[model samples]
Target: MLPTATGRIERLTLPETDQTVCGRIALVFPRTPVAAAENPPAQDLVRVGEVRRICGAQLRNWGLERFDDSVRLLLSELVTNAIQHGSGSQVGVRLSHTPVEVRIEVRSGPVNTLTARDPGLLDEDGRGLLLVDALADAWGVDDAGWVWCVIATAAHGA
Candidate 1:
């Protein structure tokens, strides 16, 4: 099934204007938070809480609250995909906040074989990107051999 969706990203000014913030990651790890961790988040799941907490912090963060659920959900999927599909080193989670939009970049070395999930109607096997595809305004893969997703702050979640 074709699962790609089209959405709007703010104008990307050229000539040297691909705005971005690149974060380097290592064999990092995070302990599952007491109540919030749905699964045993990978070793490098530290960014999950940081991103989640930052999404609901103060005014600026509170604004993220609107998009927080899908943001966090997509974030976890990207991270898990990296760990499961990319080399088991570390994954990079970059939250790009521009004047007109917000985007997430997850960078990781790819695996020799990729395993896509099977979202059975009643089976909770693989429904990662399905959620991302359905919720995010736009989501896709990138050149760095990583997965990226973008959603409008206003689009949030149910």
Candidate 2:
């Protein structure tokens, strides 16, 4: 069992696979409490905001202001997408940084598949992944509902 931000105890069933991309490791976390299946907390948005604030501070500390806007937008899009489309109550986000790159990952409950679609010019939605693809140095999705991307720190002289 793990403690949530709300101080509630919840269980997680992580996958055994140890995957690496761009020198960053991938971690899979189960969605929130399975018992209260239907009434999942709407904490994803709050978490996204928290992550943005944290990343913003970290970027400032690292002198990577050039990438701050991109990181904020990409993270927000990925987390929002997971909360809206994924099939679980909880979401997990991980950020790992190395000398050369920073990796961002968002994991959620079971999802049938992850795909990027082209949105009509008039459509307001369906552009999240497109933005991610454009901004991220590398990005992909796994069968286990893990979506990740990497940003090159070297680009910002970090």
Candidate 3:
């Protein structure tokens, strides 16, 4: 966890604003253990605020700012999937920023499946992979039950 903000919390500005374009919220599904095996994954949920904080910090530290909301949405979706689909509650989230790419990983517990009908255009649920496919440069699930996706700055740099 990040050190608690000591004084006045800082607010950040987006690079630019245009509805047609999403700034880009990227994620990397964590693989290593987030905590001890005896704990539940929910105990280690990656909160939205935390994700935003982490992403923003990484971007700024890497000399950038204002990630697209798609990054946040996908992070929440994939992390939620890890907790909802997997057994462990101590899920992990990692973010990396390179001049040409951003990668996210979330590792929860082993799972049973990763495929199903994509959510309908207006359905309330079941569209994680579909959303990832639509927004991410590419995404897929692994045999070990981990899921991940990467959205590059321009294309295949990730």
Candidate 4:
């Protein structure tokens, strides 16, 4: 659990994982904080915001701020699905990047059946993976329920 800005204690459970990406490590955090978990209606948005804050900082620290907006959107969609449909108690987010690409992985359980379905123009839902597909250079879900994506970067020669 972590203390919030208001000094209230928030429940956050981050179970450790041994997974690593391209020699970079994985960071874990709870899918939802105390208030978000208790409040179902606002759970996904609030929790995704919290996760975005963490991810934004990581990108800034890595000198990859150029990808922030896309990463944030991708994180929101991916994490939302993880919280809504995943079977795990916590969600794991991992970020790693090389000179030419940045990778993101969101894992919730040992298994997930995520697929992008075609949605009508007026449909109100089912566009998450489609957005991921459009923004990410490459993306796929692994057997261990990890939805990962890679975005090409122009940092190669920088």
Per-candidate TM-scores read 0.58, 0.70, 0.59, 0.73
Error of 4 at 52 (Å): 1.0
For candidate 1, the 10 contiguous residues with the lowest summed lDDT are 1-10
Top candidate when judged by lDDT against the true structure: 4
RMSD of each: 10.9, 5.9, 10.0, 5.8
lDDT against the true structure, per candidate, is: 0.51, 0.66, 0.56, 0.70
Off by over 4 Å in 4: 1-25, 31-41, 154-158
Q: Lowest summed lDDT over 10 consecutive residues: which window, candidate 3?
A: 1-10
Candidate 1 positional error at 54, Å: 4.7
How many residue pairs clash in all the candidates, one count each? 1, 0, 18, 0
Per lDDT, what order, best first? 4, 2, 3, 1
**Top-TM-score candidate index:** 4
Cα lDDT of model 3 by residue, 34-64, tens digit: 3334433443354545666677666666554
**lDDT tens digits, residue span 1-158, model 2:** 12255432233444434453223222233344433234335653465676677766766776667778988898899877765666665566666666777778786666555678989999978889889989999998767667889898877777
